[model samples]
Target: MVTPENVSSYIQQGLECEYIDVDGDGRHFEAVIVSKAFEGKGMLQQHQLVYRALGDRMEQIHALSMKTFTPEQWANQA
Candidate 1:
């Protein structure tokens, strides 16, 4: 089974993330992703970018919950 760390690593390989945290059991995962690339994107578009990065492995993941943010949006959250 693929680990959450592996999933995080996979996303990192394809996208430039400022900060990323992922947690999951073998089948389900949640991720908080901060990146400059997310700027100017809507919620669905942001999710599509992540989905593109995950590629085929997305099928293996039963569930994925993600909170995506631009660096500025992330900073403003606090």
Candidate 2:
């Protein structure tokens, strides 16, 4: 079974994000990710990027609820 730590590590490596919050019970997760890489991307693209980061683990992980934002959007929210 995939763990939260494993998921966090994967996302960190894959996206190189500045801020990330991951909460889950291994099979399901909710993540709030902030990265400059999302600046020009639409919602679908952003989610796709994160999904790609998770790799095939996405199949193992079940549900992933994500709140993605660009660096600028994160800064504004803060």
lDDT winner = 1
Model 2 Cα lDDT, one tens digit per residue, 20-60: 98889979888999988898999999999999988886788
Which candidate comes out best when scored by TM-score? Answer: 1
**Which residue pairs come into collision in candidate 1?**
none
The per-residue C-alpha lDDT of model 2 at residue 65 equals 93
Report the C-alpha displacement of residue 18, candidate 2, in angstroms. 0.5
Off by over 4 Å in 1: none
Which regions of candidate 2 deviate over 4 angstroms? none
| Model 1 collision count | 0
**lDDT by residue for model 1 (4-78), tens:** 999999899889999999999989999999988899999899999999999998988999999999999999998
